[model samples]
Target: MSEEEEVELLLTELFDWYGYDFTNYSRASLKRRIIRLCSLDKFTSYVELRYRIRTDTDYLKRFVEEITVNVTEMFRDPLFYRTLRTDVIKNLAAKPFIRIWHAGCSTGEEVYSMAILLQEANLLQKSLLYATDLNPSVLEKARKGLFPLSQMKQYSENYIASGGAQDFSKYYTAHYGQAKFDTMLAEKMIFSMHNLVSDRSFNEFDLILCRNVLIYFDKNLQERVLKLFDDSVGPLGYLALGAKETLKFSSIQSKFKQLNKEKIWQKIR
Candidate 1:
């Protein structure tokens, strides 16, 4: 079989056996990630990797962790949060209550970032955050709200750059090299398993933040996910994407207006 055919079979087997669909992911990036995984696992061939993934639960878990790609930090791309603080939050204040969904919220750093923004804006008491990810392992980490204490300095810098008004250190307590965030910040958050691929939209949201997640998806999957976000957001609600992502070329592009030239879109009535 050709190399292309072999990779195709591998992806098909993964979906059929594991129900985790990478069939719609960006082909080049997915291929690179899988190849890296194969090297890390010391597999001589794709077939060997497939066999291990099929029969070995531990191997499969590692495969999922590697492919799901959890490279994220608290208040990542600080300017994005600054935009949210100044523009999105200001516009949302007229509403009596708000619901924000952080889709594909890996490890909950961005989730906590949004929570902190809301808290600083005095909107936390009136807001509910829905943090969802397909990977259960990352979701568990997010639920714990613990991060390395050494990373707090960087996170604190991000917070300040993102328009944080108070001492960022006040939000967490460090112990044993880990910083556990204030439970009060998470009080209004609901973290759960949500697959953008197979899951149906559950509620209308005032704002949906799905940053840095769609770059992995192919055009078709990106359009489908964008449509889901469009349908799930209430009239005039806000939608934010990664700096490199946009609503252009998507079927729902006409449904939203560019709130920020840097990939933030607001639902148009």
Candidate 2:
């Protein structure tokens, strides 16, 4: 059999064994990540890689990390956060409390960004942020709240551009080439495992941010996920997508009104 076919067979076996449904993921991306995993594990061939992944629990743990999305940074796309501050926050101020759902929050950078924004607006204490992802490994790292000190410089600039008024240094302490964020910022957050594809709506939220994730899904899966988000959001709540994603052609497009040309939408009903 061809190497590509062998890799596909291994992936199919993996899904059947672990119940991790990655069959619908983009093929090119999946193949690239799997090949990288094989190299990292020092496997000479896909057949050997499959054997190791099936027999070694540690190898399976690493496999999960390889398959999951872990790319994120604080205040990513400064304009989006700026828009939230200027538009969404202003409208939410009158509410006594707020609940935000950060779906597919890879490693909690966006979650922390939202916490900082709400804190600055004097709403952190009254808000609950639910940050969920399918991968438990990244969730653990996110819970720690420690990031490389080198990243802080750029992240600080992002904060300023996103309408931050205080010194970003106040939010974290530097130690041994790492910066650990304040625990108080994450105090009101509940980090947990949630799979958008298979999980049901558990709570109604004021704002649901599921950015950069749907791009990996097919149109049918995208529509299904959008409907789930719509059902999970409270009436007139905001739903934010990635810059390249939109609700325009989805089945539920008519149910929401575009808040901005940058992929922000709101449930009108």
Candidate 3:
């Protein structure tokens, strides 16, 4: 069979056997990731890779992690967070209760960052941050709120650039090369597994952040996911995307007004 055919078969098996639907993902991206996984695992043939993935549950977890985009950090784009601080959070502050969904929240860094922003605005007490990812392992890590201490310096700089005035070190305590964030920051967070490809909207949100994730999806999947977001967000709610993602020509374009300087949009209809 051709490599492309093999891949199609594998995606079908994954959905049928594991209930993970990746058929609509970008073919180029999936091929590259599968190739890399094969090389990294030293598979003698695609058959070997396929067999291991089909029979071994442990290996399947690793396979899913490898295929999905999970790289994330706190305040990834300082200017984006700055805009959230200056524009989005301020508008949300007036609501008696705020619901923010972090779709594909990898490892919870950005969710913690949002918690800090709300805390600074005195809105944390009234806000609920729903953080979801397809990978359960990452969600478990996110629940702990621990990250490498070495990353704090960069995150601290990002915090300052994003208009933060307090000592960033105060947010976490470092021990043995690991930084454990304050439990308070995690108290308002709800971490769970959600697959955007097949999951339906669960709650109406005031703000939805799905940064840098749509790039891995094909146009059709992106449109479907965007519509799911449209249904999930209340009128006047904000939708945040990654730097490269946009709603310009999507099905929901007319309903959202894009912020001029950032990849954020507010629902108008």
Preferred candidate (lDDT higher): 2 or 3: 3
Residue 232 displacement (Å), model 3: 0.4
lDDT of 3 at 235: 79
Q: Tens-digit lDDT track for model 3 on 22-115?
A: 9999999999999999999999777898799899999999999899989899988999999999889999988999999999998899999999
Q: Which one wins on lDDT?
A: 3
lDDT of 2 by residue, 83-117 (tens): 99988977888888899999998889999999999
Clashes of 2: 0
Stretches of candidate 3 above 4 Å error?
Answer: none
Estimate the lDDT of model 1: 0.88
User: Model 1: per-residue lDDT, tens digit, 1-269?
Assistant: 87677889988898899787888988888888888988887888988888888999888877877888787899899888888888898899889999999999889999999888888888999999999988888999999999999999999999999888799999999989999999999898999989898788999999998988999998889988988998899989999998789887778888888865557788886
The parts of candidate 2 lying over 4 Å away from their true place are 2-8
The candidate, 1 or 3, that scores higher on TM-score is 3
What TM-score, to 2 decimals, does candidate 2 have?
0.95
> Residue 57: error of model 2 in Å?
1.9
Q: What overall lDDT goes with each candidate model?
A: 0.88, 0.88, 0.95
